[model samples]
Target: MADEVKLYGVAGSPFVCRVKIALNLKEIKHEFVVEDLSNKSAHLIKYNPVHKQIPVLVHNGNPVSESLVIVEYIDDAWKGVPVLPQDAHEKARARFWAKFVDDKCIPAVFMAIGSHGQEQAVAEAHDQLQFLENELKDKKFFGGDSINLVDISAVFLAFWLGAAEEALGIKIVTKDKFPNLTKWSDNCINCQAVKDSLPPRDDLVSFFKMRFGKA
Candidate 1:
């Protein structure tokens, strides 16, 4: 018998995109069950009772919640392309950067973009992007030649941030400010697997505008 894999997700969610990219990278066959976030399904609530969020991966009857967790799970469960590095130290470093993208970079980005480029928030966001700029200063991707856990984790910055910037009329990641990171973003979004997983740019831009009342 084959594994019964189902991903519960919303179309516009960057978190859901992360899991989708991971699945695509591994070439995992699964069902994408789109969830109306306003009226979440019983399976979503039952799988992730704590957060009741999308991007829940149900594999062979067991449930896994959280986008990053699901990505790691897919990488572990499937064996072909490695989303995480095999070396101990490199793997640890990759995990560290992915966590940073979530805990530090994401909040700073939201604060800056959500505040509509307020000086202080923009400064903090810049600092976060700069950190990534330094990290990606030499590599083609965060995982070196190919996408990895870190690249998957930072997909929001690669794709969704462009839509958010257009909708909010802000410029956080720019060629002048973050050349390396900007280049990396372009590469990530252009990667076949990542591109296949992203929502349409126009749709995402429209979503940000409406959701932020900028429409």
Candidate 2:
């Protein structure tokens, strides 16, 4: 008997994307149940009593909240094609970049979205993008040649950050600004699984515009 896997999440969420990408990488079978965070279902409340957040992975009737946690669980549960590197040191490094993308880069892009025409906010967004560009350093992916958890994290950023940019009418993560990162983002989107999973870019742009009151 196989474990029943279900994902409760919204389409636009990066948190959800992390789990989705992991499942795709492992070629795992699962059901995606879309949720409205504004009016959450009883099951979501039951699963994640604390955060009431999206991207809850329900495995064999057990619930796992938070994206990274769910990704790790996916990695642990499915032994083949591990997302993390085999070497201890390399694994640590990959985890570091994943966390970095989550912590620093995400917040910075978000700040720019929530703030417009503010000098500090604009500068902060630029700084964050520049930092990421500097970090690229000719790497094909954040996880080297293969797209691992770190690459997943960064791709989430690229997708949503592009949305936020269009929403804010700001320029960030342009091809000229961060060439390699942009290149890698394109590669990630073009990958068969990733492309299939991606929400249409134009639809995302429209969603962001509505979210930011630009529509």
Candidate 3:
């Protein structure tokens, strides 16, 4: 019997993109169910009752919620190129950075994009970007030489960061300001596993414009 896999996600969501990247890396075949976030489907509610959020991975009948958790699940369930590191310390380090991307970088980026002309939010985002830049300065990738769970977790930096900047007419990551991060972003998005997973750039810009009421 073949394994059954289904993914419920919203269009252009960074979290959803994370799962998509992971599945693609693992070469896992699954059905993608795009959810109407404004009028979420009953299936999404049933599958993820607690958070009622998207990027739900339903495997063989069991549902997995939360993007990072679902990513770890994909790495575990499928035997392919490992997403998480094999060494114990390296795995822990990867998890820490992934969590940092989710907890720190994401919120900063959101605040910077959502709060127009807000000095504080923009500054916060800059600070976060600086931190990431410093971390990435001496490495090719967060996982060193290749993409990993940390890279997947930071997909927002790769795609949506640029999209948000373009849609809002605000520049966050730049060649001068965050040179390393800018290069890392390029490396990440250009990776074979991630290239096809991203939404079209123009579509994303339009989506952000409409989403932020700039359209």
Candidate 4:
């Protein structure tokens, strides 16, 4: 058990889910410690003093914070499975999209949820989705044909984004609207690693609907 990895995250968190997906993709076995963000813990405070967020990856004894940073660590530490491409340009491209999901898409999509008169917020959210659809139309996955770090960062956008779309009573990305991306996302969710990492379909839908006061 000394060689074990421990992931500090709640089950419902999309951010936490990203770390779970990365660990599985790299074939690293880990223990999961679900945390309550409402009531923070000392360990969480100590490891991620800055963010105090879930998804602090404790590999052996060292603690790595931030989902994307943990993912980079996982890829670098383990040699066999290539998470990020070896080539610098490809690596940059991967990082770029990951940041796009992190900085742009997620926040916009999440904010449009309950904002009643927030027209700008709503427009901004759909604009990002449209941009993603355009970028994704030519590629099988965000990072080429195989699932990579970009794809991992984007899985939430594909699935949770759909749920958010439903709960928010909005349709930023739809099958008829963005058919290619919708199809690609369906493919992403079906991958064994992704499928395993996700909690459950009903649970996800229920949680999101509950958040939007539908459940």
Predicted model with the maximum lDDT: 1
Over 1-215, each residue of candidate 2 has an lDDT whose tens digit, in order, gives: 98799999988777788788889888989999999888999999999999988989999999999888899889999977678888899889878877888888778777777765366876786776676677667887666767777877777666777776776687755687678778888777776656656777777788777777543
- Name model 1 segments beyond 4 Å from true: 213-215
Sequence-dependent TM-score of model 4 = 0.90
Question: Where does model 2 exceed 4 Å of error?
Answer: 117-119
Which residue pairs in candidate 3 collide? none
Task: State the C-alpha lDDT per candidate.
Answer: 0.91, 0.79, 0.89, 0.80
Ranking by TM-score: 1, 3, 2, 4
Please tell me which model should have the higher TM-score, number 1 or number 2: 1
Better of 3 and 4 by TM-score: 3
- Kindly list the per-residue Cα lDDT of model 4 for residues 42-92, writing each as its tens digit: 999998899888789998789999889988898888766677988999899
TM-score of every prediction relative to native: 0.97, 0.91, 0.95, 0.90
Model 3, 1-215: lDDT tens digits are 88999999976888999999999999999999999999999999999999999989999999999999999999999999899999999999899989998889889988888885378888898887787788887687888898999999999988987887888788766798887888888999999889878888998888778877453
Query: Per-residue lDDT for 11-118 in model 1, tens only?
Result: 789999999998998898999999998899998999999999888999998999988888888989999899999999999999999999999999999888788878
Which model is ahead, 2 or 3, in terms of lDDT? Answer: 3
Give the Å shift of residue 31 in candidate 1: 0.6
